[model samples]
Target: MGTADAPVILVTGASRGIGKAICELLATQGAQLVMAARDGEALQVLATELSAHGAPEPMVAVIDLADADAVAGLFKQVFNRFGRLDGLVNNAGVLHEGLLGMIRAEDIDRVLAINVKAPLMAMQYAARLMSRTQRGSIVNLVSIMGVNGAAGLSLYAASKAALVGATRSAAKELAAKGIRVNAVSPGFIDTDMTRAMPEAAHARRVASIGMGRAGTPREVAELVAFLLGGQSTYVTGQVIGIDGQMVV
Candidate 1:
């Protein structure tokens, strides 16, 4: 059994992208992991990889984040098996492209359910767990689009903005319990999502970033580890942008 000295970090959406990187980083630090995502086969593979890298085998929960009942079940499993949760990474989200007028209501609702409602439920449950221990951290994966409005991303931007607001309120409400809440807003990153974008659109997006290139998942993961770890004990309710100076 992992003890308090070994941080117990729970990462949602750990099958790929930023979530995958975060799990690897925390695992490298000897943190016991409780990995959750919809892809069961992928999550099992990642758990094996983490164990190979010297981390204890991670507990896996394959559930759709959009399902509120499934999310509640996940937390229940965490409490039952882990007994304490040191940190939570609410990194599960979906991005649908289209202007506000062009997007269908169903698409918007889907985005909100996954990106906004899922995280909110996770936060609510995590807060309860942390309050018991009087120590924990929540690192939200927001987006740079939320900071500066991006064309054709109205629904996505609005969901992230709502999360930013939730992060602040949660930070304040849970401060006394020693729970630090913050957000890491990533700039354009080279991932499965971006690789799927049209070539011209990707190039245009890269040009807007001062760094002239997209960020890697590992870079964002490093920042997330720092915030979730004890290094930022005094930091709370802040949104740190990691977008390669894209919005500056």
Candidate 2:
């Protein structure tokens, strides 16, 4: 069981990249973690690593976020185990690239299911737990493509944009309950996946950023930590971008 002194925070998509960084930073903040992802092996590795580093041993919930029943079960376990939730990071999302006209119906459904529907459902569950305590924080991971536009990524952009609108609405409706909701829009972040682009292609991408390089997962995680932490209790309903000032 977790004590009130160490907040119980639930983070999804927590096995790699920005999600992994967020987990590391939050651990340093002394939070009791509940990590949810589909990769049982990877999640366990991270849990052990964090515990070794002196953070509370995280409770790992392996579930497919796209399944509504799995999502509900995730929350049910949280409530049953900890009986409270102080924070939530709706970070699970899928980005499939394709031309808008040629995209398959199944592809579109998959994108919306994980990107849009999962977070929406997670927010509902978190809100219920948060309302009981009259306090909590939610940070949704959106993208620059959501607000701006991207070729071959229209479906992904649309899904992220949906979360942006949802974030604002959730903030307003939950404010009276003392829960803050916000979205983090990352642009040209330097992750293992993004860095694998051909040299010239990567250079062009970085050249567009005023910082002369792509933003690191750690940089993105720091901003997310602030919004989730007590430091930014006054910040809510905003789409804060960490893009190194990318022109896109």
Candidate 3:
């Protein structure tokens, strides 16, 4: 176990993929983790695995971020358990892929709820929870879609773009309180999120990557780990892209 005084960081969507990788890496570094996801079984398994690896057993919150009430309850539970939060990784999001004209209004609304509103609600809680801390960090996992609008992802793109703006604004607003906020805009990663695409669509995405390959979840996890650690004390309010040269 790390020093009993080690800071606790919360990671959303910790059931698999990038969120899974982030929890694993941080756990190995001995950070106390509060892992939240919609999958209770997955969160329990991951928490157990981390505990077996010498990391503190993660506290699990199986709550849907799409619900505002649930978001509030999550923060309350966190504060009740940990007393304070040192970091929050807003990694939970959804993408309803389709051309704007083809996507349903409900699909668009759901995407906005998850990809945009959820993060905003989490940020609000983090801001309040971290207000008194001597220092804290918040990392939002954005995407290249936030910067370069994708052809068939109008709703997704708009949501992430809004997240980027929120990250920037949050950083500036909270800096004086010793809070740092930033984002990581990943290109094409070989996560379930991307793997669900059709073969042809996947190929097109691969071809667009300047590095000629998709990134691994572990790669993105490392960047997030760095941002959460004390090593990044001076870095905040910037969106670091880990696209393997895709978004130049």
Candidate 4:
């Protein structure tokens, strides 16, 4: 068991990219983590690594975010094991790009199920746990595309946009109960998702950014760490852009 002061944080999408980065940074800070992802192997690897480095061995949950029941059970397990949850990072999401008219109903359903509904459901359960303690923080991983329209990513943008609105509304409703909710909108981060873009299209996107480069997952993770920690006690119901001035 972890010390009382050690925060118990649940992070979805913990297998790779930004999610992995967030887990790494928080481990260094001595947070007890519940890492969730569909990739059980990767999650186990991460859990072992964090343990080897002196952090508590993180609890790894293999879960498909599309299953609403599994999402709810994840929280139930967290509360049952840890006794309380101090933070939640809703980082699991899917990105599907296609012309508006060409997008299929199934694709839209898949994207929204993971990107929008899963996080919303996870927050619902996390809030229930936090309400009992009357304190905790929730950070939803939104996107810059959600704030600014992108031609080929209408479905993804719409889902993220909905999350942004939910973040604000949840913040208001939970603030009085000592829970804070916010979002991090990363712009053109160098993740596998962005790496798959055609070279020319990728260059054009990077060049358009004021920084002239794509942000690293660690950079985005740092912002998440700050928000989850005490440094941002006054911050809540805000959508912070980590796009290197790309969306300002």
Q: Highest lDDT among the candidates is held by which one?
A: 4
Pick out the ten consecutive residues of candidate 2 with the lowest summed lDDT. 189-198
Per-residue lDDT of candidate 3, residues 114-206 (tens digit): 888988999999889999675899999999997889899888899999999999999999999999999999999989999999999999999
Per-residue alpha-carbon lDDT of model 4 for 48-159, expressed as tens digits? 9998998977999999999999998899899889889999999988888898999999998899999999999998999999998999999999999997989999999999
- TM-scores for every predicted model: 0.97, 0.95, 0.97, 0.98
Error of 3 at 230 (Å): 1.1
Backbone-clash count (model 1): 0
Q: How would you encode candidate 2's per-residue C-alpha lDDT over 1-248 as one tens digit per residue?
A: 35357999999999887888899999988899999889989999999999998898899999998899999999999999889999999987776767888899999888899999999999999999999999999999999989888777799999999999999999999999999999999998877657666788678878888989889889998998999987998998999988988843
Stretches of model 2 off by over 4 angstroms after superposition: 1-4, 196-200
Please give the CA lDDT of all the candidate structures.
0.91, 0.90, 0.91, 0.93
lDDT of 1 at 84: 83
Model 2 CA RMSD to the hidden true structure, in angstroms: 1.7
